[model samples]
Target: MSDYVTYDESDHVVTLTLNAPEKRNAISTFADCDAVVEAVRRVNRDRGVRAVILTGAGTAFCAGGDLKAMRDRKGIIEGSHADLRENYRRGVQAMANALYECDAPTIAAVNGPAIGLGLDVACMCDIRIASEKARFAESFIKVGIVPGDGGAWLLPRVVGMSMACELSFTGDQIDAATAKEIRLVSRVVPHDELLPAARALAARIAANPPEMVRMTKRLLREGQHMRLSSLLEISAAYQALAHSTEDHKEAVSAMLEKREPRFTGR
Candidate 1:
């Protein structure tokens, strides 16, 4: 964790908050990207961390890249054309990959605007719960650029190809209700309830067997790019591993005893 991203954990859930409120929590530099990636890596390294919630401080979940930085060619965008390409590859793209490959289940608490890279990052999560104040846009086109952080691949998978195309092509903003209608976000709550809702969801996920949850998330990620037959084989292997965990036996015993299960993430 650093100045850009704040990390907090409790009850097997880690929350990473984008902290640059004055710039609307925009990721302005390579260091900002590193902070996010590090936070995710921290979550993955902790076996007790069963879930993650990504949100932002103040308002605006994230306003994407800083406009001033882009205009001035400072920070992440500072360099020649070739340098810019490398910057993106090592900067935002790295952050995106880290989040996408995170072992624990991730939930985005979209408290406000999630534009361009912000929207894309939210999509990287397994679940997104938005505040009524939340707004979203795949607006890279507005800046005469493309999604250098994998939005093209991530967006379509979340909202379908046609809607993704429309959003990217037009650079238009959609409110929380519209996002929910298009299946972009799973739930929308009042602004004050956003964090609570996300935390509740994370708690529910964390209450389950931790290893099984991580394996299930891995299987889901693999299924995205794998053939069904291949996925079945991998799932079978995971099922074998799952059945061997003490948590699994505890779950079975708890069920048979007709009592609430207490998972130690064993």
Candidate 2:
């Protein structure tokens, strides 16, 4: 964790921080996008990591990609559609899949500015907590691009379709209070409390039955596009799987004994 980013874990919670604050922690290039996907995979793979919190090291979560970097690639229209699709498709899919398929609960602790793709990264998480000082935007249109990460899909799902459209079309920035009001963010606290609160939430989730949590997360993600009858079938299958876990027996026993359950994640 030599600080292009750092992942620190304790008490079954892992915190990932974007370390390049000098550029406002902007993920300016394809490599930065790749780094994010890699980071997500690494954090999710740690067997002991039950939950995760993501934030930036200095003043901002991310200001979006660097304009100078974007300028350099403005003339690049030489590739075939298939090549472009395959190249970016893999990278974006890796990022979206990392979050969508992650077994543990993930939270974005927004320290300050979040814009464009930065906001998409926030949307990837299960929960988003922002500092009162934080500002957010969907600035893709401002830069003459569509939201390339999960924004077009995720933003509308999180907020309403109209609101997502407005944000994307207008590229308007919103303060933390407005973001919370619009349900873009779940909570807002003092800047110093952002990481602490995210950690606390993650720890609370981590303390639950890990196997059940992972299964539930998977079901919820899959159920979004599934028909009601199909979802019911999936739920039953997962319920059967859950009932076989040793942790499930412990949960039942603890309830019978009126005691807190100690889950082994088995």
Candidate 3:
């Protein structure tokens, strides 16, 4: 993508790094959001990509919107009321939609402060792994603005409604330890080990059958909003497709032979 974001793929895993350390990798302008959306689209289209790891370049996972850009009315914060609504829908909202719907399993490696939209970004991922230095906040209300980037919907689903409301109302920053306590992050590692931990997790996921991994993630996403009966129906449909993959046959044979499975993304 652009210099704002960097994309790299290796060993069935794709890494999308927010590259703007000068702004703490802020999802500031439409271009920044576009970069994220494009990266998500790229990995989702690549069947070989079994997992994705999203993290920031420097110390901050993301600092949310650029305060300078907002103050100058130069980015998403610019435009009239109606125009701004459309801007958000097309810009940040679109980015969220892309990541949330991406079929590949995603892990957010929260390296540092993930505030405002940054927190929402982590919630969008399938799992979140944070550094001990990492901090999080749903601080939109502190700036007298709502979560224009879907945080209201994403955060509650993550930490539950009571915790979500408390964070949104207080606009307070919680450390990585507190985040883990509330189930915001699944794991917290030393600052230096953050990326390594995330990659290790990604590698474990990448070792599975690629098609089954993607389909399983889709089933889980759909289950979040569907009835139990509906989810079971969808699950059955997905399982049938999974059962037909060549990789599935290989996996069964490997188990029977007591050998590691070799999957060719079938």
lDDT of each: 0.93, 0.82, 0.92
lDDT of 2 by residue, 7-47 (tens): 68899888888888888887654456566677778866776
Model 1 over residues 20-110: C-alpha lDDT tens digits? 9998999889899999999988888899999999999988999999999988989989888899999998999999999999999999999
Better of 1 and 2 by TM-score: 1
For every model shown, the clashing-pair count is: 0, 0, 0
lDDT-wise, the better of 2 and 3 is 3
Candidate 2 Cα misplacement greater than 4 A, ranges: 1-3, 74-87, 90-93
Residue-level lDDT of model 3, residues 69-151, one tens digit each, is 88898888788999899999989999999999988999999999999999999999999999999999999998889998899
Reference-based TM-score, model 2? 0.92
Candidate 1 segments exceeding 4 Å error: none
Clashing pairs in 2: none
lDDT of 3 at 46: 83
Off by over 4 Å in 3: none
The weakest ten consecutive residues by lDDT in model 3 span 1-10
Error of 1 at 256 (Å): 0.8
TM-scores for every predicted model: 0.98, 0.92, 0.98
